[model samples]
Target: MGWVTGVMVYFVVWWTVLFAVLPFGVVPEEAAERESGGWRGTPRSPAIVTKALWTTVVATAVWLVIWYLVNSDWLSFRTGWLAMPA
Candidate 1:
């Protein structure tokens, strides 16, 4: 993929991975805190920095795999059974 396309793909992959990683190692807020006055179901510690770092690592790996597939002949939509009629 070209530089622009690769960047766009990575951006999408990063956001998708972020949502998937957001709930990891989460701790629910205390019952007292929930009853007092606050948003319901808030995590005690969201750990945004840690999650963002992990998202970057995972997204890079995923994007690399996609880049390989698209650049290599191992998998292609324009050939074999995946080809479309002109």
Candidate 2:
């Protein structure tokens, strides 16, 4: 259950950041103006690819931080042990 919760939290955080930063990186003022009209232009694939790459990097960084905190005893919980008792 804890692992599931952690995974959900990580996904939420990563997606939220991705959506928030996406506008800054991908939405030029002119592009937004154009989009506001009924005629929407196709997004550049290269930009989408770059955003995915950045999102992956950010997500991995977040995961590593969470993993370190949990493993270093900085974050403790009352749950069934998944590892051999020390």
Candidate 3:
């Protein structure tokens, strides 16, 4: 149960970081257009989504490594959170 809670916490933290960093890469192109007096346009490139997905994958990997290191002695079960004790 404790290990489940810890994993949930780690996931939440990882996602939060992912969102926070996303805008840095995703927003700059628009900001550049606005700064240059160009009309803001939608991101039509599939690369944006691809980059975000890749970033997510990388972030998840990093989070997993850190989590593993911090919880090296703990056992993490695969059951859903609701199945674990509060």
Candidate 4:
């Protein structure tokens, strides 16, 4: 894939992974705490940095596999069964 496409793909993969990772280890704040301030569903300890790191790691691995397939032409659409009919 071209550099631009590769970057776009990575960006998408990163955000998707982030969403998937966000729910893990989440514990909502107590109702009493919510009354003091903040959103009702806010996590007491979101561990955002940790989740972001994990997301990056997972997304990188996934992106590498995609890059390999595209670069090696194993998943190429320009030829083979993936090619469009004229």
Taking every candidate in turn, the Cα RMSD to the unseen true structure, in Å, is 3.1, 7.1, 9.3, 2.5
Write candidate 1's Cα lDDT for 23-67 as tens digits.
Answer: 999987755354576565678789999999999999999999999
Residue 64 lDDT, candidate 2, scale 0-100: 73
Where is model 3 more than 4 Å wrong at Cα? 1-3, 24-48, 73-86
lDDT of 4: 0.89
Clashes of each: 0, 0, 0, 0
Give the TM-score of each candidate: 0.79, 0.53, 0.39, 0.80
Candidate 4, poorest ten consecutive residues by summed lDDT: 29-38
lDDT of 1: 0.88
lDDT of 2: 0.65
lDDT of model 1, residue 30? 55
lDDT measured at residue 45 in model 1 versus the true structure, 0 to 100: 83
The Cα error of candidate 1 at residue 65, in Å, is: 0.1
Assess candidate 3 and give its lDDT: 0.59
lDDT of each model, Cα atoms only?
A: 0.88, 0.65, 0.59, 0.89
The digit string of per-residue lDDT tens for model 3 on 1-86 reads 27787678667765776666555533323544655665565443335565567667877777777667555544444344434565
Alpha carbon deviation, residue 2, candidate 4 (Å): 1.1
lDDT of 3 at 60: 75
